[model samples]
Structures are given as C-alpha cells and as structure tokens.
Target chain A: MTSNASGRKNLTFISRRSPYGSGYAKACLDMVLSAAVFDQHVTLVFMDDGVLQLQPNQQAGDIHAKDLSAALAALPLYDVDNVYADRDSLTRRGMFSDQLAIEVRLCDADKIAEIIRQSDVVFTL
Target chain B: MTTLHTVNKHSLNSDLLTSCLRVARGGDCILLIEDGIYNVRTLEDLAARQGCELSGLQCCVLHDDLTARGLAEKDLPDFISAVDQAGFVALACAHRQSVHWF
Candidate 1:
C-alpha cells in the first residue's frame, strides 16, 4: 500500500454519464478499480446523468453491455467502499436510495465539494 | 520532473497515441489504459527506436485494462511493462503530473 510511502493521497472519480449510453460510466468504474488495486485511497461519486448508473433492473438487452451493477456490487471487494450519489441529482430524477441497484450514500452538493477539496486527484469521467 | 502521458483511445481509431508520442518530452513516459492498450505494437516500435531515434521514452500499459479488453500479456513486446492499479498509483505519484488524452 502507498499509504506508508507518503501520506495517502485520496483519488476521487466522479461519474457524470448514464450507464450504457456510452463508455463513461464503465470507464469510471474501471478507473476506480484500478486505483483500488494499486492500493490507493479512492472514492466514487455519481452525479448528473451518472445517477442513472445505480438504478435498479438496468438492462442493456439489445445493446449488450456488461452488467455494470454487478461490478458496482463488486466495488467493496476491491476495497472501494465509498460509493456515493448526488442527492439533488437523484431527487431531480425522482430516485431514492431504495430504488438503487446497490448501496450508496446520498450526498448533497456541499459534501461533494468537500470531497473534491480533500482529493489529491479528481477524475470526472 | 517526468510527466506521465496517459492515452485512452485506440490507435486505429484516434490520434491520441500519435499526439502523445509527438509532444512527450525526453523525461516523459507513456501509459496506455482503456482502449489505448490496443496501441501496444505502436508503443513497442517507439520504445525499440529509443537509441537511434527517440530517447528516454518509457512505455507501459495498465494490466487490468489490457485484460479487460481480452488482450493477452504474453503478446506484448518486451519493451512495455504491464502495471497493476497500485503500480499506476505509484506512476501518478512519481510523475510531476498526468496528461490524459482521451
């Protein structure tokens, strides 16, 4: 772990695209997984269209993409336990935490800003 | 300080690989991730030309991204090293900054 090499730097990946419309959501997940594999401290935030990524029963039936929810569920396994969704983003879409496919904390804009402030690197995928 | 130029597109489809190669300085290193791993052959060629043409340019690919795309590591030439996510973190830490060409 790089935690001891230097004070651990937090890398936060912000996902702003909906699932399956393009590669953005998957890219964010993959990048987060990579950071976690490197043993770097990392967090993932879903905002904007990204909130759709956590929606339950997502089916790419005809488009044929990997089941991203399964991967989201696997985040904790990779030590990426800080998955969060923007509260306003979710509310605007009429979504609640119970409606999500996986577990993620609902965060407001202020908290999102704080996380960004604390991050050494912020990747907005 | 060395700059880590990260390319995240396919060579056959995008110009990110060529652009990174053209502008990357002597101390800079190229890291292929996402679809960029498809350019391993191009990167290997650049690495092979280090002495006669290019100088001090290192190349590597993200192992997870490579395998996620169903690419085999054995096929990668000896010039490029496959690094895990932690290795990627070390690279980002060691370099002055990262330039991602999507």
Candidate 2:
C-alpha cells in the first residue's frame, strides 16, 4: 500500500451521498477527518448526489442537522487538500464550480480514475 | 493499478451503478453483488442512457447473487461474466483497491 518511501499511505474517500439524507455522508466525513489526523495522504472526491453536499447556503438548521459544509470547510486546515468534484455530476445537477461552498479541483472520468489508481485505499459511502 | 468497483444496489432504485461506471476506467473490474445483479440485465441500456461507454471495461456479476435472484448464467449477456465466490476473492486480490457503490 506504500506508494513512496515515506510511510504515508494514499487514502481516497469517495462521498457519493447527499448531505443530511442519512448518516452516510457525515460518517464518511468523520472517517476522512480521522484518516487525515493519522497523517495519511487523503483525497476526497465528490460525485453523484455527493456533489449536492457542496451546494452553498444550506439551511440545514431548519432540519436540525449540523451543517456539513462547515465541516468540509475545515478539511483544508487538517492538511486534507486533495479535494475534487466530478465535473459530469456538477453539470448534471446544473451546478457550476463557482457555486460550490468550497473550492475544489474539477475532475472528469479519466481524471477520477487516475486518482483512484494512485490511491492505496478507497472509501466510498 | 486497477480498482475493483463493487455495486450492491439496483439501478432502477439507486443511481449507485451509474455513479460507479462514471469513474471506472479501462482494466478496472466492476463486480455486481446483491441487488446489483439486476444491473447486468440492462447495463448497456443504462450506460447508453447516461452516454457512458463500456468498451475495454470488465464487468462481472456474482453467480450466487444471480442464482439467489432467480437468474441463471445462460441469461447473462455475452459481455458480462458470472463469477463465483472464489472468483470474487480473486478479483479483489487482482486489483490494487476496491470501491463500493451502494
């Protein structure tokens, strides 16, 4: 699982669920944070309904749920900087990158594959 | 390195299969398990609907799950293979990593 001489393993987390639908999205985020805290190289990819979690101005307070976006915003501070969103998913949802709550690198199918290929572990939810 | 993408939900009920196909690449293996076996019946149709090409992609369905769902090997399409439990483990070992789409 070691990609390089450094002891860090590449961990890729693919979040494919919408925020607040269930605990899947939140649970995945928790895993990502835990992995990052352990000093593993983390990559987060948002695709399918998971891209919906990136939508800005969420009114999650009305539903009595913690704001997922706020947790996501803290990812950068944790050194989990390899953030990406599927381009096709965003387009299918009529969401522009500029409209997302946080900045992320946009990736197409091939690019996504490249990232997954490089990863030593892939977590999906 | 190749990734083994496992899909466990039906496309009609969930878009997990479609989402799995979106990032699956050539040489990567896609194994359908549980309700995902239903995807073998309409994989091409769904891929076409989503405008995703399946060329050079390896697709497989769990034989046990297929049988459990009342499907037989004879009913499978030419492009997809029916793998047994042992084959499933082999596929997982063959790939560098695995991703589950549920």
Candidate 3:
C-alpha cells in the first residue's frame, strides 16, 4: 500500500466510539501515532459518538480513565495533523466547531466520502 | 480504488452501519457480518431513516453469518445479495482495501 516517492501511504483512521467506553478509542489513537512514526500520511476522522472525545474540560480522572485529551494534544507533535470531524455528527450532538478542545477541519458527508475514496488504507474503530 | 466496508453490529445495538454507510461511495461494497446480519430485513429502512442513498452501492450479507443467525437468502432485500466465504474472499481481492466497522 506504499505510495509516493517517500513510500508513505494515504492512511485514514475513523474513530466512531466514545472515549472511555472501551479501549477502542485509545487503541485507535495508539495505532495512528504508530503509523505516523513510520512516516505514513495519517488522517484521523472523528465521527458518530467519537466527536465527544473532543469536548473540553474532561475530568477523566474521576472515572479512572486516562486523559484522552492529553494524548490528542500530542497529534501535532507527531505530524499527524490531518484531523477532521463529521459535521453532521457534531450538529446532532449540539456541539459547535469552536467548542472542541482541539482544532479540527469539519467535513460534510460528501467530503468524507471523498476522503475515503482517496485513502490507500482505512481503519475504522 | 474501491473499498469493502464491513460492519459487525446489529442495527439496534449500534449505529456502526449508519456510520459506515455515510461515507461509502458508489463503487464501494458493504458486507454485513456477525450481528450485522440482523439488519438484513431492515437495511433499506435504516438507510432511509438516516437519509443514506444506497442506489449505487453493492450490499452483501455473509451467507454463513446469515445461516447462523437463522436468516435465509430470501430474507434479504433485492438490493442485497448473499455471499459465501469464497465470494467474500473474491470481494477482498477485488477491492483495493477493506475497512471493518464494529
């Protein structure tokens, strides 16, 4: 699945579950970081209940859960900056783009479809 | 490149199918396995309720999973076809990549 001169593939990760509900969110994050370490072009799309992971002021410690926001904040450092969130998902939950803890490019259904079509590999978790 | 999007959850238990259908393109294929086979009878209704267009998409249900779930090929909508294990493998070979949505 290698593409481009540098051998980077268009890797897309779609996170659709709520953080802390299970290990899926954390595992997905770990996989993304790992892919970035390999110099792959990683794109993360947060949709469905996954949009809730971007909510600010999360006190995950009270629930004995790791701080996902802290991990999410490290995305830019890893150069995995192609972050997106489904517009419909955010609106359905009454969340606004400005309210998220991190900056994410909001994508409509059609844009998301295009993203998938362009991906060389897609991981949905 | 075409993608095979596989969903493994029942419609009522999770919105994985809806989420998968949202981004699935025209040439992409959707395979329902595990509890996802439970959606055989209501896939069209669910898609309609979510405003998802399935006109150009190829929908399939795993035959083994359908049999295990006590469903028959006749239960599937005309838009969907039953694929055996070999057919599933053929689909994987035909598609550029496969995404599993649970």
Candidate 4:
C-alpha cells in the first residue's frame, strides 16, 4: 500500500496568509487533508501571518467566520501530523507553541527552508 | 524535470503571470486559478509581448474558480484548458514539483 512504486512524495502545504483575511486558511487546510486522503506524505508549515492561524480563543462571531484553529487542530485525524510553525514569527507576535491549540514543532527559518527544499510538491496559500 | 507552477493572481493586476512565464521551462505546466483566469485572454498576447521562449507549456484554469468569478467555459481562451479540482490534484501528482506563487 506504499506510494513508493508510484513515486508519491513528501508534499508540503504552506499557509502564509492570515486566518481571517481571506479563504486561504481553509484552502490550505483543505489541500493538506485532500492530499493526505490520496495517501501523500503531507507536511503543513505556518509562517509569517500564517502562524496567526494557530492562535487560541479566536471568536470570529461578528464576521460569522468559521474557526480555522479548530480545524487546524484536527490535522492529525486526517493523517497530516507533520505541522510546523516558525519560531521567529511566533516570537515576533509574542506567541508560543503553548498558546496554540494544536501541537506544532517550532522551527527556525533555516529549518522551514529545508522543509520546502525536501518536499516533492509544495502549495503556498 | 518540469515544474507545475500555479499563480493565483491576474496578469493585469500582478506581475506573477509574466514572472511565471519568464521562468517557465519548456513543457512546464502553468495552472492558473482564482483571479488568474482574468488573464487567460492575454496568454497569446503575453507570449508575443514578452517573447517568452518556453514552448509547449500547457496553460490551464480552474473551472470552478472561473464560475465563481462569473466567467463561463466559453469565456476561456481556446488555447487554455479548464480543469476541475480532481484534475488539479492529478496535475500535481503528475509533475515533479508544484509551486504556488502568491
């Protein structure tokens, strides 16, 4: 059942936009889940404004927007457990992994670049 | 080793289309979605204008996105193909790499 014969690869989905600014947050999550359903090895990276999506207690009632962080926390259920957040971005925003709803490994810029370089396919939203 | 490059902006509003064309390799696939369809009519014109040397590069647009923007199938240029969500996923799997330009 391995994708090795088919050469399926480590797919990277980068979410660099804010959670509430546009539909990009949902789009990025959808892409990772869809790719995972296809048995692709998927990793999700949140950087820049993207890290803001992981913030806790986001009440978007006024905008009637869905809670993106809730869905982001459900990635493991979709088999997309490789989630990364930029440390500098989180710090710049005065945030930490403890403030996020999901379990994400804090990575530096170099590590983030390494993930991009190693992925067979990357989708940035 | 062709890259399946996806640009989500329109040519008129952003240089992404031209930039993608500038760096595209021969036979590379360019999938335009979201506002990118707004530039479909200009592909031939863009090629001529920039003299982009990449040959046989396949250009496509997402059908659903086009409709969301009130563009129909007939609105797409003859040279540009319309692909669905599944086709988009398949396109990524078919290519060596997939890059989405913001």
DockQ of each: 0.02, 0.86, 0.80, 0.20
Q: Give me the candidate number with maximum DockQ.
A: 2
lDDT of 2 by residue, A1-113 (tens): 45677778999998989999889899989999999998999999998899999999998999999999999999999988999999999999999998899889999988888
Clashes of each: 2, 0, 0, 0
lDDT of 3 by residue, B1-102 (tens): 888989899878888888887778888899999999998878899889978889878999999999998889988888999999999999988998898888
**Model 1: how far residue A80 lies from native, Å:** 0.6
lDDT of each: 0.77, 0.90, 0.89, 0.80
DockQ ranking, best first: 2, 3, 4, 1
Tens-place lDDT per residue, model 2, B5-101, is: 9999899999888778777888888999999999988899998887877877899999999999999999999999999999999999999999988
lDDT ranking of the models: 2, 3, 4, 1
Highest lDDT: which candidate?
2
lDDT of 1 at A7: 61
Number of the top TM-score candidate: 3
Residue-wise C-alpha lDDT for candidate 1, range B1-102, written one tens digit per residue: 466779898877765665456446666678999989988877656434532234476788999999998887897878688999998999988875575666
* Candidate 4 per-residue lDDT over residues A6-81, each given as its tens digit: 7677888878778889888889898888998988989898876789998888887768988888888788899787
Write the residue-wise lDDT of candidate 3 on A7-79 in tens digits. 8899999898888998989999999999999989999999998898998888999998889988998999999
Error of 2 at B49 (Å): 4.1
